[model samples]
Target: MIGSLLYLTASRPNIMFSVFLCARFQADPKESHLTAVKRIFRYLLGTQGLGIWYPRHSTSFKIVGFSDSDFAGCKVDRKSTSGTCQFIG
Candidate 1:
């Protein structure tokens, strides 16, 4: 379930934080974590039309990228978690 949600995050950036929060418990999830996951699914159902959309244009395009990372951000494994976003114009 978590894996599926994570994959969906590529097109649905709004759920990224919530999905990652639930992902932290993949190895030893509890009832509370399950509830949180259910909430995310409910949210998705409520906002079925939400997602990234690009506008149509003609001659030229510009691509921009932004990224950030934190060292040892993970509590369980002390691994870095990084994120990036790209924009086209």
Candidate 2:
């Protein structure tokens, strides 16, 4: 279930934070975790049109990038996790 949600997150950036929080419990998930995960699915069901979109128009090319991190935000273990993505011209 988490795997599917994580996969969808590639295009659904809106759910990134919620999905990442639930992902921490995949190793030993409990009922609460399952409920939280289900909530995400329900959210998706209600907001299926939400996703990344780029206008198909000619424009000056430029580099794009993003960075994210969890500062001691680990749920199971106290480990800082960081994620970054970049698009260079």
Candidate 3:
């Protein structure tokens, strides 16, 4: 399931964080982790129309990116998690 979700993240970037979070417990997942994964699936099902689209023809191209990170956000390993996204227009 984690592998499938990771593949889907290539197009559905919105669920990347949730999917990766759930993946951390793959070796010893608890009931709550299972519930979280289920919730992510439901979210994807309901948001099927949401995704990035690129046009074939364009005169001008612009690139934009944003990134953020937290300090020691992970309770289990006390590691910071960071995320980044880019857009082209």
Candidate 4:
């Protein structure tokens, strides 16, 4: 199920973080992890019409990117998860 959600992240960036959190527990997921995954699915169902939009014929053609991550954000392991998004015109 996590695999399917990861594939959906390509079009649904909003669920990326939740999916990543659930993915980290794939090796030995507990009941709480299952609940979280189900919640994500519910969210997807409610927001099926949402998606990215790009404007055409922009006078300024440029590309921008941003990324940030917290240090030791994970409680189980002192690991950080970083995310980035890019916009091009």
Candidate 5:
């Protein structure tokens, strides 16, 4: 479930953080994790028509990229995660 949601986040920035938070618990998912997943699903259901849009007449597609991560943002198991993206100018 979470995997599918994460995949959708590529075009749905609004749910990125929430999905990331829930993903940290996949090692040993608990009831709280399940609830968070439900919340994400409800959110998607309520915003089904929502989506990303890029203007067809935008300027030259100059690209920029950045990334950063904490070794253990989640205090549970000390696993790390990274976020990166290329932005157009």
Candidate 6:
């Protein structure tokens, strides 16, 4: 199930964070993790119309990216967490 969700993340960036969070427990997933994955599937089913779109023709384009990190954000491993996003227009 995690594998399928990871593959979908390529086109459905909105679910990337939640999917990856649930994936972290793949080695020893609990009941809660299964519940979370089910919630993500439900979200995708309801949001089928939402997605990123790219124009086929354009005279010019601009790309922008933003990223942030938190120091020692992970309670289990005491490791930093970071995320990034890119926008094109």
**Highest lDDT model number:** 6
TM-scores, one per candidate: 0.59, 0.56, 0.59, 0.59, 0.56, 0.59
**Per-candidate RMSD, Å:** 5.6, 6.9, 6.0, 6.1, 6.5, 5.5
Per-residue alpha-carbon lDDT of candidate 1 for residues 10-33, written as tens digits (9 for 90 to 100) = 988889999999999999999999
What do the candidate models score in CA lDDT, each in turn? 0.91, 0.86, 0.89, 0.91, 0.88, 0.92
Model 6 Cα lDDT, one tens digit per residue, 31-84: 999999999999999998876667667667677999999999889999998999
57 Cα displacement, candidate 4 (Å): 11
Q: Which regions of candidate 1 are displaced past 4 Å?
A: 51-89
Error of 5 at 36 (Å): 0.5
Q: What TM-score does candidate 3 reach?
A: 0.59
Candidate 5 vs. true structure, TM-score = 0.56
Tens digit of per-residue lDDT, candidate 5, span 1-89? 98999899898888999999999999999999999999999988999886555677767755689998888888889899988987866
Q: How close to the true structure is residue 33 of candidate 5, measured as C-alpha lDDT?
A: 97
> lDDT score, residue 59, model 5?
79
**lDDT: worst 10-residue window of model 3:** 50-59
Which model, 4 or 6, shows the larger lDDT? 6
- Total backbone collisions for each predicted model: 0, 0, 0, 0, 0, 0
In candidate 2 the C-alpha lDDT for residue 20 amounts to 95
lDDT of 5: 0.88
Per-residue lDDT value at 25 in model 6: 100
Q: Is candidate 5 or candidate 6 better by TM-score?
A: 6
Q: Which lDDT tens digits does candidate 4 get at residues 1-89?
A: 99999999997888899999999999999999999999999999998887656667777877899999888899999898888899886
